[model samples]
Target: MSTLIGKTALVTGASRGIGRAIAARLAAEGALVAVHYGSNKAAADETVAAIQAAGGRAFAVGADFGTEGDIDALLTGLDAGLGGTGLDILVNNAALAGGTDLENSTPDYFDRMFAVNVKAPFFLIQRLLPNMRDGGRVINVSSGVTRIALPETVYAMTKGAVETMSRNLANSYATGKRGITVNTVAPGPVDTGHPMFQIPEVVEGTAKATALDRMGEPEDIAAAVAFLASDDARWITGNTVDATGGMFLGPRF
Candidate 1:
């Protein structure tokens, strides 16, 4: 499965969870990886170490993803890490969950969520597009809440924007035989070490929501991203490949 043998990848929010798993998966498939982190230096280093231990090439990079100049700094660092070479893969997976709801939503929360989950990645791709080699791959980590309308109004709206961007970018690059491909991978009720699952109501509710009678693991989503990044998946783009383990399917109970 060395489909990415000659590729270079930048995976943001790669310090832990799905981001960490995707970073390792790409490295394992033989891509030179730049693992991006936000304030989790140790976790980023650990990702690098684990990849290296498995005989994969990877490095750790850091940037604040929600602020001005932060994304440029991240791109600059990634380029330097690759020795000014072209990029072949990008996983825009870093995200912040604004606990803001209907009544408590603040101007600051809306601003921050849109900035990180929508504006930043959208522009970062634009800045890096010139450097991305033809036939490149871009996987945006999205959520199923957009379809289910789970009350994460602000967060889900931003990811919805990502979904639309991916489809448009895929069409934009459709002319080239080996041009870039962009797609969103949406997961539902993933267990990313958040303590919310410990709450009895949350646990029961999520379990009932999913036909699998459980939640998704981070690796499940990462595995899907790895596949989409491969040449075998070159024909798959401009689509939302749901990875929710039947969570979004079945008759309403």
Candidate 2:
């Protein structure tokens, strides 16, 4: 079960929800994990504690992704935590979720969304590439909204950009010389702690939209991500794996 033994992984936004699940899953496979958080140090610590309690190794790293010098801050903390080891897996999972239609979206909100969801991952990867091992894996958490109509236009746009980045990066590294893999996992209607889950009607509607007849849980998406991060996925890259429970499976009749 220790598929990732002697490896290291960094998962952003590991304070809670999907990010936390991914971190825990990777650590379970014996990866020494760096659990990144924005401002929720307590939650990040809790994540690390849980991993440790399970006989896994993990540590908390803090960085506000959208802010200036964020990549530098993250790398600094990561370097201190890793001591001298290079990274084997990097999961870009931090993002801002709220966005409205064009008419309702403000310039500030759009900018912030792109900054956190798009710009941060771009720079984080750019900076981390040097430290990532030759056979490393880079996984971006994307949204299924990119493939379907969604009211959150700006959020979908950000995920679209991430998918594009993943494709280009994967192609760029496809030579097999370095063997690094870049990919995206797009999840639909995940039952995270987001406020949208507060409404019973919305939850019911979301469940109905999926072929599985149930909304996805954080672990569901994490399972897909875990598979992609493993050696079995060595040949897969530059693609979006739909972890959406067959959401939007067919045209509405």
Candidate 3:
């Protein structure tokens, strides 16, 4: 945890749920965090306030993601926040989770989800990498559903892109033992504040599927993200950490 002292992190979609938890965790571990939200200013500000109250440094920033001006300003502000310390970590945690089966999914659904979940992370990293400190970290959020062949092909495809990017970026970055690592964090059925699926039957069924008798919490995923960002995980690049509660053990249905 102390490994991140004096560093800075830019975490996207950090207004609530998983993204917010990750931002707070990073801050608690001593990184000055920039909480990036797409439109939820209130939730983003609350995350920043919580971090500061915990004696950690944080700032809130909003970017529509994929818009030229927003991305540009986000990178600029991220660079400035480092104050010459350099951007030490980037958590591409923002995503649009929607349900659509192969039989009825629309192209528009695919486009919007890909733009946010895949395209945004791809370009955001490209724009921010130059300002990043050497031997820094990048973590992209994937999902255990990819393994389960979940209903949302568009969303899963985007996350697969994230996993591939983790490998490719690790190869391109991390020169000469400077100790940078890039990895994917995939969580399964973590409570992301969307309780539409939180019915007793669903919860009970999900719990029965896991060795642990319950679904995952956002902090469960956040803790894994924190580890990948830490020096303790320097040699763990190009890998995907499965934070699922044994939920992807077999088929979905």
Q: Best candidate per TM-score, number?
A: 2
Largest lDDT belongs to which candidate?
A: 2
TM-score of each predicted structure versus truth: 0.93, 0.95, 0.92
Q: Where does model 2 exceed 4 Å of error? A: 173-176, 251-253
Model 3: how far is 235 from its true place, Å? 1.0
RMSD in Å for all candidates: 1.9, 1.6, 2.3
Q: Who is ahead in lDDT, 1 or 2?
A: 2
Candidate 2 versus truth, CA RMSD in Å, comes to 1.6
Tell how far residue 9 is off in model 2, in angstroms.
0.4
lDDT of each: 0.87, 0.91, 0.84
Q: Is candidate 2 or candidate 3 better by TM-score?
A: 2
Q: Write the per-residue lDDT of candidate 2 for residues 1-253, one digit (tens) a residue.
A: 7889999999999999999999999999999999999999999999999999999999999999788888899999999999989999999999998558989999999999999999999988888887688889999999999998878899999999999999998888432459999999998888888788878898899888888888899999889889988999999988899999999898555
- Cα lDDT tens digits for candidate 1, 105-157: 88888989999999888988888887688889888988887787766789888
- Residue 54 displacement (Å), model 1: 1.8
Residue 184 lDDT, candidate 1, scale 0-100:
92
lDDT of 1 at 223: 90
Candidate 1 ranges beyond 4 A from true positions: 173-178, 198-201
Candidate 3 per-residue lDDT, tens place, 95-211, comes to: 888577788878887778888888889888887777577778989999887787877777788888889888888877343255667789998887776775568888788777776
